[model samples]
Target chain A: MKNKVIGNTDIVSGILDEQNEFTSVYSKGQAWLNELRIAGKNAFSEQGVPKFKDEEWKYTHIAKALGEHYHLPHTYSLPANQDLSNYKLLDANTVTLVYINGIPVPELSDKLISEGVTAAPASDVENSSEFKTFLGSVADISNHNFSACNTAFLNNPCIINVKAGVQSPKTIQIIHLLGTDDNDSMCFPRTLIHTEKGAYVEVVESYYSLPNSNQNFCAAVTEIIEEENSHVDYYKYEDVSDSTILTTNTYFKLQRDSRSESFTFSLNGKLIRNDLDIKLTAENGHAELHGIYLPNGQQHFDNHTLVDHISPHCYSNELYKGVMGGSAHAVFNGKVYVRRDAQKTNAYQSNNNILLSDEAQIDTKPQLEIYADDVKCSHGATTGQLDDDALFYLRARGIGENEARNLLVTAFSGEALNEIPNETLRDVFADKIHRKLSVMSH
Target chain B: MLNIKDLRAGIEGKEILKGLNLSVGEGEVHAIMGPNGSGKSTLANVLAGRDDYEVLGGSVLFEGNDLIEMSPEDRARAGIFLAFQYPVEIPGVSNANFLKTAVNEIRKSQGLEPLDSKDFLILMKEKLALVEMDKQMTSRAVNEGFSGGEKKRNEIFQMAMLQPKLAVLDETDSGLDIDALKIVANGVNALRDGKRSFVVITHYQRLLDYIVPDFVHVLYNGQIVKSGTKELALELEEKGYDWIKNEVAV
Candidate 1:
């Protein structure tokens, strides 16, 4: 069968069986993790997978894509000759952390030596108490089915910590490569980032799939917490093969006077859904969410974001742009919330899209829920085709039609791409986008 | 040289240019003077191969190539340029980047090597002087927030940079003041090299005073009704277009 379904109850039943098998193999010296895993499993069982009837998942039907039998494992061996230098960001000082099939291989990681900074796989610190305090604290697994499922099947979670008053000079690059060897496999990759007071850091997370690999499904969750007075810039770039399905959820928590900026660049993928939620829990916090997704062919990309202002005097801004071509489809749902006690909150959200073909489409919704009387909030969304006048303007200047389209698209995505804090990483993303556009034109 | 014979074109099934005829020789500047709705802009847009206008009948020949059969970019590559009546605004695309891409594409089509960054910047700088354009404008998004005069100057700046064989200026001086008009006229005049032709379209004789066209044509109701020397522009200016309409009606 192309898409084998196990029904809702059967899926949760399978998870319970996998949890028992995992407990027998991985619960050695990690009873606390097993307890957390049990809690996550119970949550997933209670809330099964989201179907088309769900309000938040109305546009995207995830059940069909997840209908195939999937294998959940802690680790898998990668090809010895896996070359990743092709994906490295040029001219950026990066401490590369490479993961093969949800497990981190220390041999493939760069030896990091910065003061008050800790970067390693979660499996290495199974005995640390900090893991229990930070793992399920940030991400809301109770309400999110994908997050709960990911937490229940956590393998080798990549955890990054920056101590108070410390600033990392190099960006920590996390590269996850999925290789299934034709098994129609599945993996869950977990990550947690905790920055103490007055700390600063930049992280780049990228996901890729090996060529000729089996059809795979990845359920990943990354939780990030910024303590008081901390600053963080997080960038996620997704460039996977056409045969894989990726559902990733990231949560960010900002304390008083802290800042958080995150940008997601979805270049190419098949059935990708990204969920990003940020919570400003203290006063004087700042958060910026920016993303650009350029999809072609039958690729489907969905981005859902929530910015919750839980405290007073917080600021948040979001901008997302999409360029859909061929028969591709995209969905963007952005929601901003200003709590009743969050007075003087400022939140702004905008999502813009350009559809290149008659069949290509996008659905964008920007929402604002404000309860505080003293707060200022605004949201807007626009979907349109490329401006015909602008296209002719470029073509009349001796530029070919295809090149003109590429230029306009590259420029369309530039608004969000240029906001990347690091110039080197920004150029890296820009270059990838340019390459993608050229390929699309051909 | 450019030639248009019995060119009939329109948009939305409504004929705009019924049966127009015009010709421009090498090293000559031809000014197309007409009143509002006289198909002046239509003629210019048709020459640039704009797809919106359906050429019902007639042919446009430029340097032995059928301009009617070519795409807009091909017409441009074949040294045909149309300075728009209203330049379009493109956000996020820098003027410099747009110009560079246009220049390189044209050069590549002609089997010429694309200019390197340093050489391209030097060429842009030289052309900026021709239009008195601020160097900073090149780094800004293309006409994103440019004033009317600035947009007009930018068109001429691009014309100067591209240096097309036949440049069609469509109402290039409509909203400009005296000072801005002078700069625009000077910019166009500086590019008038031997063998380069221009078809300047305007409703008034104000712009022709600076460039001083060799031949003047008055277009009325989709066709050229009168053709003469530069003095004809002053005559139309003194007598207004009512006389031309009356003459054409007869």
Candidate 2:
């Protein structure tokens, strides 16, 4: 606290100082979301940016990042007709949702009208009954400053809805492109995904920053709710520029007999913090949380996941793997909580890390708190280097040193990649990982 | 041809291969038999350019090139191959991909073009019969979840695929049963040509039965204490290593 910036001003006052600017940009017609914004603002005032002293933020230090000055909403304009052909997925039939600076690009979006899926801007449904039930329901911003701040500046939000008993024919691709020319600009992109009973959909969220767009900050909040017997697959790929800082919080709520699988791929960023919370509220709910973070060149990645099993017969499994190189730092804290009434809960969590360079550091902790006696919970964490014997074996087979290391590193991420469930997407991720390795090898 | 002269190497400041000497001519299969801790594997590992083994003093010549100066992979590209006693399991890399990459790397170093996938598959099919390797194993991850005997056979299969000029088998017979040993030996014998050589390092003399060696050398305390014909293996088998130790003492 002694080395604080902004003249001892807390994060709330610093952010709320731009309230008039935010209101002019966001508060147009909707009184409900405006009321929610007031709540979020109040919450941020009560709880400022999380400090290292907080148990949840024990490993990730956000004070320094929050202390910096960032231009909030209404300060930047979207670039015209950006070329994204290179970022498009090849040979896949996908519904593309493009967002620039947290605002949906109507000209670039494609519709899935025949599939009974609605991909539209979140602001369109601000007054709808479904939006009232789904928005901000999964994610709680009461004690979270970043989430609260994101809520307070929510504009041009993305909403995806799947009707009951309808199965999406193609994957939904959401591209969050940051094309801000000015440095130190911040954007809060909100996404709400809701599925009715027996509906199935797969969504991919990709984050990218244009060249020379450094010092940009993005705070994203995504809430996904799966009704009874619904299936949801969510994949997040974070590959921003080195000068950007990204804080993302994704929430998942599963009802009875519903299934959900979420995969997060953190490949490149300056500093990234991801908080994933899953709540299984009804019986026989199942959820899987899997992620792979490959950080190099002074980049830092922190992932904190919480799986709360509040209903009986709920199951949750989490596995995260990371490879750090070039003085990179990574942290993984996975917590599983089975409540007292949640009997027959089965929760498993594992985190494995490989420090490619001696200077690279990794701090991983896997914790499980099961208040119910009938639960089966297990957690494990391991940090180590590449296997010497395996490396030598590959080398002796005429593979070069770098090639051998790349082979082993790629192999290390194979298990998590296999959890993607989709064949083409899995290959895309595998290729991305290989390309990242080649870049690092140089 | 391969040659080693007074090769002294150690690990962690403790000398293992002290004043060792060996020479293998082209077309010859030389069996280097030694008891446990006698530096048989050490000699094999040293020739493979394993960095963990510090060579205190040594000089090795492989096809007139200084073997000591080459990296492990360079040595491999220069037609040297070592079948590890404990084959490492590299998860997520298919056995076929590993062999293809290895063969292509060696071919590239030799200024030869790589084999196309079809040609490589045909070659793989032909070589799979040498060790009776299962076709399914080729598609699975390299050596992951392989049985001990199958792992050893996989080693020989890889040797066949790479077609190294000088192959060093480091206790390839350690974990194999009699039947598996015959399969591995048969595979090795089939690969023997007038232009290639092998340094078979084993603790048991029984492996020498199937892949009959042109020469047998008894290694004692890191040195080749005795050199003789194929009959020398039987002599060592019956008399045990103590006889050689006693003879050296005398």
Candidate 3:
């Protein structure tokens, strides 16, 4: 397919030229993997970089945000004894995989000691048949430019495999620290998780930048395959500095009777875009997509999600809420599709936003397309400010203006936060939101 | 404790209160009665510093401090409470949490230490019982899903928690059954101390039957046309506000 050249094609050409050098030096000896990389490169070259003319990229201009100068990752190292305490969301007992500039640091990571589960960097498991079968199968690279770009530069991707009937005892944490002080750097971090039949696993992926780091861009991709009767909970937390430009594409493939729940929290960033796609292929599949994004101070955050129900007796529910302040801009586009074969499917989607300042803006659209006659689908979007009567009511009770505003904002946000299943992790996210709201209010 | 001289107020450039005047000493309960659009609620709102009502030309002194100059929150911190005719429903904020924040903020303004959780819960329990409110009500969001009577009772419950110096009931009896009205009046009666004053603004005289007022003022055309004892309430109730309006016209 011929790709249309749009605004700012310099970034696309630069990335294409860089991919040529990247593949030659990092190509694995495996023929299938090399072929996959070549396919990804060709797909990216065809798609080029998403511009404002693209419907999917209308609200988020990726090429313009990337600018013309950026160096793809070559060699990166973390300083010795780096303080990561602020970045760790869970305790030390949980299995944690740390990645710096898209490369895993095995020495600092915990080995998966649980039975029927294997967690390792892709390089360590590249020869395994399971890794070869599932790496590029779940996520669609031909249609999504960022996913294709991520695939083109995929090197040492994280891989986690869980056998059938295995319920992991602890939550798996994947922490990606992307930044450098030398020059503007860009890295593609890839992840693949496959759970066999009747398996249950929880994964939390969080992104952060090194302290005082220079400009950095991170394009990440994560694909999860839930086999029959399996359940998976996926959470992504993005709290990078203002100098970082991050984009993530997360895809989930659920089989018969499989359940998946995913939460994306875009708390802080300069410019961030998230694409979440879920495909319910077999019967009796369930998926819930929930997210909370708080963008302030000239930041731009865009969330685009799609849930496709293909078989019968499937259900998908999505709720994404945002609180925008300063001159921030946010976009939420949620689409749910129920195919002809997806009889008795139930799909519900809602996106609500609160703009704190006059300059803040939110564009929310909830789209539902159902080809099945016997299905229940609903979609709604609301963008509003804080309730004046509620604020006055609080102040009338003697609460100060700032405290009252915070109270109302927190209440508005708690509707989404309460959906988190884990109590401790919910509290952590709530605290982060509260602290960010306090700063935003001031 | 409260004084208003030539208080003129309005909303959206439409004058509602035209040179209204009234005064009440400490420990007194003054009932201000008038028909609709007579600036009865406007007076109540102006006293509580509601920003929607513009105090065009008004001088209100509470404890000898300029009341109009203070913000609504400061007015609240300084011991003024208005029981809204239609209480705002705030979802997701538990009644107990909202009251706790209010109590602490008022205490902070008074230069006193905030009550600890244990003491605050104990206080809440006491106030809940005083207002005849169920203990479960505190766990729910403020005024959310609450019945009309329960909302009024919640207002009195908040009043009990804050224990303000002056309570302004802005048509608190607007929507309530006899049972709920009695419960609310009982709550207000329980809070009455010798030093606390009350401005019970009501269009109906039925509420005065439960808690007798020391003075009854008939407001007409934004001004008090007549002042008398509790008997004036019964007189107005029997004849309605027509006679008072006629007397003012004459």
Candidate 4:
């Protein structure tokens, strides 16, 4: 892989070199990628990441997905009749960018220069040191070939930058509408949102695909930076009609006294995996992550998240809840790391899942890597069906069996759903999950 | 009207109710007094269509319909209400919301229009007054954070809200204080009507003093071996159950 360094810092040149693999994190990441390459698994290449037939990939295997061998078409018939109004984020009056089949949709995009917020392609920001140095630098993509493959291919990455001292609140929504030409061509989209000192901004990235294509790969990476006294709200929504393979990676870093909150809603995807990383670099930094994933009809969803605390007096909290049925499977792997000097760190993580079917399965692991003896760090994971006692009580009161189950599930996932503070948005996301449950009920 | 003939039921392999028979017409109140493990709760559960109990042989008719064959929800829709002895606690589900769901479900089953939120709240407030239930209990999760007396009062409160045709009070007096018992008994008394009947199951004769059962049946072991008027409850309270168990060993 040939990489160029346009900035004086040469961060990408240094990061892309094989010599950086000496670092432990980079080493493991590289080793993982090496194994993936050996296993002949590249997202687009003929030798893809090893199939789920292997034990490590058994829970979620792309090999079993239909049309896994389709070649990426240079151009897809960009469907023009598709609508984008429903993809708007709450309070997204500032600026928005809608991309369909890698092309921007004009009518629904928010390119308001009057608001002093500028949006452009990755190349526009590539000239700035802040963009190139920090873009793909922190992510140890050495062996996450899927990530590496994405970085190697995604040429039209979007850039959203919020400069220092800006306030009053601004938001941008990135909508990706899958077209029939990309019909079978996997798309690797990337985004970088930089919130400088005292700047407050929000980015809502939503994925909406057509009903015909279940044979596409959506491997994306989104990076965020919150400087001192800044606040960043990042939201991601995936509702792909249960026939897509989507893997999203999020990397975020918080400066001293900064705040970062992320909310994710997964309504429909045949196979979905989300990798989230939040690192606190200074004291008094706060990070919060909330997610809701509802999978039905033999769909598979996986979420891998890590929160790293390097400075003392930082706090990070996470809550992920899922509703699965119809032989649906959900796997969650959450890891929290506390450095030796990161004392007084308050970190907690909980992953709860409900099995709506006897065949529905869930595997959750909450990993804690704590080096600080004086810190309060705890993690918990539970997978169970709705309470039978509650079910009977509801039924005994005349609530039909199906309605009773839905109510219990809504209650179970209500904790995660509460993170959506906006009432209308919360209801919309919850309703989407409810609709998915109704489909599975049949 | 309700009737049970040669009823035998139990959980798992152990028989709880054996050869129990009784009948009650509309507007009548019957009391079943028994020692623990003598199948008192089992009878109430069977009547309410709880699946834990297996009715080996029995015939139960409610309003001339086969009550034994109906599902628990169907039985509830058919106007049978049981005040659970140890009411289960379901956290994260508010009492008011639960009751609303129940009320609407029963309404749907009976072909009656569901109560609007305003009317439902008004009805709940009215029922709360009868049981003297505090608002905190209804605002919190079902049976969660409730005291023993509050739980019993909640049972009566639900009975008030549902307005069932036949209500079975299962150990409603077991954990209540003098005041809670009075409030519970008074709530039941207020709901009594010419069209609805009640079956009160308890171990003590105190509750019977409040409701004043028209017929008293002494259940020893699995069978209702003795029957009498209200005087029978007074005699059981005096002699205790050991004497009857020994006397009725045959």
Candidate 5:
């Protein structure tokens, strides 16, 4: 039997038709911004929504998941006295910027009090030259359809700036909440972080749908530019409702001697896609990308990462792991490229997965392209079920079957979770993993 | 405390234990010596509830309960332990954490509160001394990168922690030096408090010299063809199992 496939035109036209109306309400009277939006819209229209025909989207049928119609979020308002305590992470040393439906809610967020740091909504700094110079420079909208779509409908984009030789006192957290009031709604959240030379900062972006929310779509794009000798840690935490479809594109451009580490944790969602791209443009630059995804119960999660070594003496490493159950499907595609000039480049990539049910599926690919003869590059991928010997070993020691499975899964995920630097965040992610695994075991 | 009558078991479709009978009372150590391919390890595994072994026809009674009807964890909670011949290596799980979870799970099954961290650590220290294990060893991954001797010692250390009523040693002395063997035997002897019973399955009589058993049984072609006191072990050591094959031929 042939499946009823949703055409790419139907998905693209639905969003393209809203461009004129969206610009009328959200435009800030900036000519450059309008040009950028128009460029983004044109790029999106030319490419359309990726379909099975697209080589990169061969395994993911995203267009079929998108219905014929979706309401674009125009107004933002939270319920009166809505308690947001459950969505907060790291209370003491964190500067939170809360967003409800892509609109910043300053009253619900913590102010940025650290010296030499500027964290605010884009509207507050629209006229600044730094915002214009670094906004669309890092992310490649011409190639990424989701990034282009997000840029076209961007609303109140968050901006964070760190000056030269300054170390931020606290971690910056961006929290986006999709409320339950709007069904079939979509929101585009954007963030730009630019760090000057010798700067050190940590940023975390988390996506969550309000409790009981359903059928919401979130497209988020974040661009980070690290100057020479800068150090940055970026984390993306996604735990939305089971009916939410999330697509995120994060780009990092590192200069000489700059180092960056990124962690993506995808715990719950209907269909999620994460695209992480890192470009080491100068010598002595390093990048580390790590991710852990646990998708169960018909959920779909895909992670695609690319590390480009453009200069000599650069290093890149990537490790991604997934635990799938209940007919869920997960995909991992990681690529490392070393140019001819990158003589001393060192790149390593690995992807591992465990399927808890017979119906569960995983597709993993690790690719490396090295032109430099002196470079050290290695890539490997593995997919299998939990070791029966390990399970029986635990059960033989009196651990219940459910608990035994939990321990082994926890151990499997701990390899990625241990990469988090903050202790509190590590514990929080550990708890989330434990809770999700317990639910899947049943 | 334990009884197996007419036990017939095998793996994958081939019968190993044709019909075996054995009974052990409390505080008794019974050593079973056999030639290669004998059913000594099969009996030990079947007793510990290893699912791979198919018990074609058998009845295992531990304090009047049908041992075969219970799950491995249930059997463990019901006071049964098996010191594996080749202990499985599990990475990313600390030895101490594994023991803590096992002890607490057993306690939970017996309607007892879980031990707190301080008390658990103290208990761990006490058990570590029984096998002469270093404190740092417990902090490492469970048996990962451990030597043969250390792995064997770890099994005995876990047995001490769980304190099961019936312990099945499956070739525990297969790969151990004399010094490590003596330490392991000493650890086992310390637990002999006239209550717990042990079934030691081995290929050689060297291990029995340290932890002297009260009864010696010869397992040949899946049956206990010979049974006697500790002298039987010495006789097998001196005359070899060929003598037993000759006797059974008659």
Candidate 6:
């Protein structure tokens, strides 16, 4: 069986044999897993979510990320009184959903219900074929163990939907604050988002780790479906504990005249790998993928983006910038595929990096495969240190050599931070950059 | 106060400044005119501490200290400036921020408090106007995508802000229209003072007409072959460098 059931069977056998009575989706999940396992499907083993053995993952060793078996969050408890002031939405009129350790904390939000926005824990995602199919659809799970593992055991997810033509000027912030007690724990977080025709909204998946040495494994899968004329700007602001490992997979489908954008900023993680897939499935659909990752110390951050042009007259542009210091290593793999019949497709991608230290390393690759003749597609990758003349110029003006170099490095990273639209989120991203620079200096 | 005694330096062991000697004390603009391949650039690079060029033999005394022992940045911190023939391009670093950082670093080396953003802005505005540069240039990355004229203007702009004790303009007027040349000259002129000195090296005498130096020395092969006053530049312009080589060159 080439279907998704066998993978679910392995998942059900590992985490759900004893407690399978809570939801019907869980039962169906096991049933499908049993059927697929019986059929003995193994065609996808060769395509294991792009591995370190693959040229694309040469720098970022996902196998190391996959090797670590994380402890499941055994329990959940919202501190009787925790602070949410720092995470307040930029637009007070916007809705807010708070989740602490994979469970929704409704007490943290009061104005969301009155704003006509629905926010809840996704305990039944397996019931929605669109949701389950979207998770296993784009990602090459066989290549990525965390993605496949996440699909089998996702306990709860955040579900968000924007109705047709109802545009909210404010933003929707999905806050995932990993607690301090569960040091060395992991969780599978699935988020489903849908925008109907002519709908417009912005979603910020903001993560923070309460102070602790916990090696947190957050395998989150986000699926975004945009109807005709719909627009969705999905911003992912990841700030997990520096000692933790994070793997997040996201897929977006853009219909005719629809627009989808995915922007992410990675900070404070032991190892963070993100897979972003955007498919322009209808004529005139557009997608933009932009992100900035500033890694310090021995942290490892990787971003793999795939923009698939499936129809004619579609457009996609991707630019990912990185500033790596200390002995930290960053990896970027951007792939653009212009399908056979996707004529008149416009796709451009570029990855540029600034290595702030001799010890710092970065591996960036841009791949463009176009079968369509009437298409314009281009890609380029560059990595280097600050220019000597610029450094001397600053020094000649009386600036210390190190300070001048730092200023130049910080400025080089500003182009990517500007992509995050929310002011609060932008500030957070900038603050992380500033903090990274400060740490790199020492 | 600068003294170069029998200085000789070169790249890849081919000796350029063979026993070159020069002396300048506070408040002097000395021009060094030369044909191609003279040790004029070698002298400047030795004093400025460019590591790629080797100092085969030299005793460069800055005020009193042995200048040869210092690193290039230390030499700069000690108040030596070399306006490069070809300025480097740095993307993503603003000119204003770069200058402010340089000014503060030099000041700190001299045991002074760092300049605040407000004071730095005030200083940058005035120096930018001196080099005929707009405020926008100050916000742009240093020499990134700048024309030759703008790069030269930025060089002078940096000189004005740093107020170096000794400024070495190494072929600063090589690629400029008359207007940009005049602007660069004005920037240098405005920075001239009793406590400051300049070593203006050029291939043409037109720049000397604008800066009007106190001395003009002709460098040939690897040594200064002729020495004269401001009139010598006019003579070099009218008689041409070949005449000097065939007539008085040593």
The numbered model that scores best in lDDT is 3
**DockQ, computed on Cα atoms, for candidate 2:** 0.84
How far in Å is the alpha carbon of B106 misplaced in model 3? Answer: 1.6
> On a 0 to 100 scale, what is the lDDT of residue A400 in model 4?
79
List, residue by residue over B154-245, the lDDT tens digit for candidate 5: 99999999999989999999989999999999999999988999999999999999989999999999999999989999999999999999
**Compared with the true structure, what per-residue lDDT tens digits does model 6 show for residues A213-314?**
366666677788888999999988787877667778888989999998788888768888888988899999989889988888888999989899999999
Give the TM-score of each candidate: 0.97, 0.96, 0.97, 0.89, 0.97, 0.85
lDDT of 1 by residue, B1-250 (tens): 8888899999889898988898899989999999999899888888887888899999889987899999999999999989999999999999999999999999999999999999999999999998899999999999999999999999999999998999999999999999999999999999988789999999989999898999999998998999999999999999999999999878
Q: Rank the candidates by TM-score, best first.
A: 3, 5, 1, 2, 4, 6
Cα lDDT tens digits for candidate 3, B16-133: 8899888889999999999998988888888877789999897999999999999989999999999999999999999999999999999999999999999999999999999889
Worst 10 residues of 5 chain A by lDDT: A1-10
Rank ordering of all candidates by lDDT, starting from the highest: 3, 5, 1, 2, 4, 6
Candidate 2 per-residue C-alpha lDDT over A210-318 given as tens digits, one digit per residue, 9 for 90 to 100: 6668577888999999999999999999999888889999999999999999999998998899999999999999999999999998888999999999999999988
* TM-score, candidate 3, chain B alone: 0.99
Query: Which pairs of residues collide in model 1?
Result: none
Q: For residues A231-267, could you state the per-residue lDDT of candidate 5 as single tens digits?
A: 9999899999888999999999999999999999999
Give the winner by DockQ.
1
* Model 3 quality (TM-score): 0.97
Could you give the fnat of all candidates in order?
Answer: 0.88, 0.77, 0.80, 0.59, 0.64, 0.52
- Misplaced by over 4 Å in model 4 are A1-58, A63-70, A73-81, A86-96, A120-130, A168-170, A179-183
Worst 10 residues of 4 chain A by lDDT: A2-11
lDDT of 2: 0.86
RMSD, candidate 6, Å: 4.7
- Give the residue spans of candidate 6 off by over 4 A: A1-59, A65-68, A78-96, A108-111, A123-145, A179-184, A357-359, A422-424, B12-15, B54-57, B65-78, B104-125, B220-226, B238-250
Model 5's DockQ score: 0.80
- Considering TM-score, which of the candidate structures 1 and 3 is the better prediction for this target? 3
- After superposing candidate 5, which stretches have Cα over 4 Å from the reference? A1-7, A29-31
For model 1 the local lDDT of residue A42 reads: 71
**Scored by Cα lDDT, where does model 4 land?**
0.76
